[model samples]
Target chain A: MNTIQIRNITKAYNGVTALDHVSFSFEFGKIYGFLGRNGAGKSTLINIIANRIFADSGEILIDDLPATENMAIHEKIFCMSEADLYDTGLKIKDHFKWIHRFYENFDLEKALKISEQFHLNTNLKFKALSKGYQSIFKLTVALSLHVPYIIFDEPVLGLDANHRELFYSLLLKEYENEERTFIIATHLIEEVANIIEEVILIDKGKLLLQGNVAALLETGYCVSGMAKDVEDYCSDKNVIDSDELGGLKIAYILGEKSAIPQGSNLQVSAMNLQKLFVKLTEKGGI
Target chain B: MNTIQIRNITKAYNGVTALDHVSFSFEFGKIYGFLGRNGAGKSTLINIIANRIFADSGEILIDDLPATENMAIHEKIFCMSEADLYDTGLKIKDHFKWIHRFYENFDLEKALKISEQFHLNTNLKFKALSKGYQSIFKLTVALSLHVPYIIFDEPVLGLDANHRELFYSLLLKEYENEERTFIIATHLIEEVANIIEEVILIDKGKLLLQGNVAALLETGYCVSGMAKDVEDYCSDKNVIDSDELGGLKIAYILGEKSAIPQGSNLQVSAMNLQKLFVKLTEKGGI
Candidate 1:
């Protein structure tokens, strides 16, 4: 069953629309990538679903019911934003205690273990921790919340390579055990492409594309060959973008692989999500 | 001529070594990716070179002369770190003015233009800006500095996808026009791999690998084939890592691609920098 649904949701601030007729439904027990360019209303949509912000029109439903600012609905969903979650004056240990008390599903042991892995100092105040450590702290809290639907907006911002990998690994483990739904909004598309089951692309406050990850990849291909060959092959097709490096030309095109012309020496491969995002956003034709 | 040089630099805090015997020299006009796992001394190394911290031993020289907190050397090198750079009370516009007055090469017009692209509020107090906008402000300053050498430590941390791409495009344009040296320390390796001419990998306070980007890619290859074929080809080689999907197996190995046994149905491709990094660091072997 779909865990969350949004229908023709629209929001505006001072006559500037932040979300316009956005509609999508997220399934349960799957990981989804909420992707978009900057100011594409990803955060706005998430906030509206979480009931942290009001939409000007339409409806949002959680668990097949209207999702207003109801405490029960809010309890089942957790949205971890990119901004620092902890108050500046609170000590790390105190913050942990507060989270434990606030969320009935909070796993204190798991939080402690994660803190140990990250080598976080519980005595240190929020402002005293390094940026990387602060991110780790917030990640631990979010993971331990154990909500039915968890949303992470750019969760690995300050994490290093090792920590970032660990975050994904932990998410996978949690998914395997609990089967909860996860929505991740991030620009690091390639890194998480393998982990996400579905992708939803938003652009300029509107829904651009939404589908199964594998299905999207099947239709989007990157063709590389000689400049003349690529130009000729892409002339009649939807060539989203093209780039030349030395004598080789690579064109991002939308079509079946069988359509590629013979004798072109073309190497057609699935487009990495980041490359696809760049091409689509630049062309504004997704 | 080398723009910056580090010779056997070592740094410690309360007897805990942050950087150990690190040595590298950056050329005058190339983009370098300073990569490492968390706590691998990337920041320590850059901080020392920027004269913000002192090395316990060894020397840092810019233009063949020691970079010892001297105004002449400092003025030519710009280091934009993830740390907060502005006083809390100052307005964003005032901070820009302060930076313009302090840095002789700062371009006020370019800074203003970048601010507009990022949609930053010039009237907002430094402390009032969102984390993302704060990062944008710092990036704008760095772009406008126009220094001979610039070091950016995770400069795109809070930026959205569109702004991040814009930053990269602007960086390329700046490099092409001015031929300035730039060292970007980031965990988002794949995003910058295309633009970086060289890469420096660090792990646990030690240098792991350093080489030209093209040469590094040539050092290893990814071989994909049937499970048995992949296993047989990788059995006797230095298989850095391997992943299996259904009936297909892919192995990342160091050594010449031609060394693989014939009749293995092996197809070899270049290894991605990010995948290689995860394999090398996460496994603790290369």
Candidate 2:
């Protein structure tokens, strides 16, 4: 099992840096969440990794081979993205045939089976299908590839709740059968919070945090009580954010929580991934 | 307080039916989730109510008054839809001004304030902004309008996780202050599951279910045990779906939960909205 190693990656657009010499490595067989703000260069980095675009500097290595222009590693990675680079005139069945010509490991029969489960008519032209079906079609193709690394950039976009749930289940089912890696970059954090084994957080073209999902979730917690009592307790600690409901105040604290004295009128609860993400990215006084 | 009553509405495109005798109403001052799969007629019904398209038959009454091009009722309803119907050349400020010209009650100050909070550049032309910003700009305008019923068709289309969280909080904050109805038609059901007061589900151009969220959640549960034990227990019940991980079997049952004999080797867990929707719409012998 070889890992994708990204070393000192840097890219710029019109003199503005998009990736600031970032370095990270994605292991071979784990589900990871690549999170960031709207324009935080998540797509840029992903595009660079897929060799669709070039980075200004630095290198990407699939084990020991350089990734760019190397057909050896190209088949090892597949990306299901929002870009409409597909042949719109081609029917789903024809597209599957087209993908088969590009990737030797592509499975046309599996794609057809998955499309049936999604209720997607394989005879319909790509452009004729609605937005949700288009996404579903792309996902079906992506999952049919026998690649070591698959990246999904908002793969569930425009999908209804039922379809989204089906996708997650299918993803888990596939993961359980193969030793492959899935880098899912999405806006629905809570939906994937518990599913992802590892998290790579990016903000404003930089890495904010990266670690195990469980460990990161344990980094912060909420302490709630009377306004004055909570304020006094959080005076010396790193409080990420606070919520106020009438006389009650809930303050989210970062780092390890120390022992609380007896009879302190404070309630502690674990912070969920959504709350942590919101507080980390929230501007002052929001 | 008024309600948007949809009575026996029907529509079709070309030879295919879109909405088949759909009838439902969104009450004033409540947030409702209009749920459906792709091509399930959610957008068709919403378009008919917003007067964007003409229904083949039936009626929509805004407080007992016909809502077809009736200026009195039109001003009371505002829809932030996915269609790019805005003038592209106009800046954010100019668009707000244009809306103010048409909507006498449109608050320009509120729009500007909300835009600032979203960090949206108000001087850029509508066409220059990214997809996420476009949604934010639309939401800013929609929230500024003083109307009895506001409809959102995929409001958070391209927003990031942080922005989506912000939108939900802001929506609840606004609803708390105003006695207005919010009919949010979205694909991201779980995001709005807890926030929405009611749920309206549709499938195959027909009404599936509509009721309070809590009541719907209580309608089903998951029972798990050994394969034989679970199958035997579910033989006399309404089983929505079931899963088998190795020898352990899990069955999702709908309707009232009955008494289980002691040491029956079954565990019952509550069902979430997403799970219930998937089970109901899922087509197969899984």
Candidate 3:
């Protein structure tokens, strides 16, 4: 199979488990949204997949081949994390040249082209670039690499709205040009809602849900009306969360949405991706 | 006047200007969104208001009293910035006690209550907390202080969806309990659109626009249909930005939305805050 498969991967840091037998797979070509709450071990899983760290148990396979510490499959995947790995003293263009020499599949022409599109100055040193530009630099490298799988961890961390929109459009263009797997782990769910084809949710180092974005959004909805009316309508529904404002009430439900009764005062609305993630991952109190 | 009046504030670092004759007033008892692109001098202006940095020219007034280095007006305002000002060695509870002595209106009781509501372990040291928890601690201090003015610089930087939602509700509750000025500088425009009453936008160290949020959103809208239809409809309109995908087109326009023709296929929709900000500030090309 042309996929990156994980079989019971478990990792721990000083006896605290970060991944508890987390098993999942990324098919050959699809854009995925990897979502989770803080301290949910997203970075841990990404690092393990990139071979930056070792998992205590289980294995990662790429096209049925072992992925752990195997240089043969190194050119197949690229992970752009938040941590700065490039030399601070090196100029942007110089770093691109260095990466071209290191990775067999690195495309220097594409790197310069993307840099031009983002208006990134190639003459500036890594340390001189602002936080937003630094993110642009990292994403430029990820976009330039001809890898089958690329993971972007917080790609737009410090970007403004214009730059973020530019990045998304560029990503879509790249996806259209080639069939490759792109996994983005970010907190800005609403912005990526329309871009990602599928979603993989993790909570407490365990896989909670994974499916098509449209299918998942279809299951979650909101029913709002007068306080008493909302309560009566949601009495038999699967209410995940709710809010009350004086006489107005809204109940967030997770299940097949039913038709409103005749002369009912209730109104139905689709639950957005961010709301679904929050309601499913939130534990206990506020 | 119960407001923070910035009178022709001008500041520069080295030879480059950060804020050039920028003037604006944040009135009392309302939430305002301070929005701008990266390197647009938001932090520079915020630091001047907080008295952490001085402006080369002009003055800041709180209720008609000079705010720069004025000890009398210090207690009237509190700025919770991204930079950490607390002692990293001290426990959360200990830090709260220390803050109690620094500010005359510090409410220790409210601080403890807010911490408990966030499920923050007050016994843990500042350095021991994660990035999300650190943001929560900073916000807790800001909420506990009974000041007439408060500024939050990227308050939700490392926070997850649940925490961000919790912070927004807490902020609204705080505003409801006491009518005070709250200035939030964030890149997440859509999330804060409904919460803010007014908006202050700056670009390239200059004030671009400032007005009521509802009025601003009402002025910006989008017309979408066939490429030719959108072009024809927007030819006389104030089109700010546009996108073309195959045969479809989306033209973002700023002005009164006129009624479409009886046989026209163009559809008009309200423009979102993020799109408005992007179209207004984006220059040159993608």
lDDT of each: 0.84, 0.85, 0.89
Cα lDDT tens digits for candidate 2, A138-234: 9998899999999998888889877887898899989999889999998888888868999988877777788898888888888888999899888
Say which candidate scores most in TM-score.
1
How big is the positional error of residue B213 in model 3, measured in Å on the Cα after superposition?
Answer: 0.3
* Model 3: lDDT to the true structure: 0.89
Name the better of 1 and 2 by lDDT.
Answer: 2
Write the number of the candidate with greater TM-score, choosing between 1 and 2. 1
Best-first order by lDDT: 3, 2, 1
- Segments of candidate 1 deviating more than 4 angstroms: A119-123, A259-264, A283-285, B88-93, B116-125, B259-265, B283-286
Q: Where in model 3 is the C-alpha error above 4 Å?
A: A222-251, A260-269, A283-286, B85-91, B123-128, B222-252, B260-269, B283-286
Better of 2 and 3 by lDDT: 3
What CAPRI grade goes to candidate 2? medium
- DockQ of the candidate models in sequence: 0.58, 0.66, 0.66
- Per-residue CA lDDT of model 3 for A1-286, tens digit only, reads 8898988999999899999999999898999999998888898899888888999999999888788756878888999987788899999999999999999889999999989988899999999997789999999999988899999988997788888998999899889999999999998998899899899888998888889998988988999889898888888998988877668898999888878877988878777889889988875211
lDDT of 2 at A131: 78
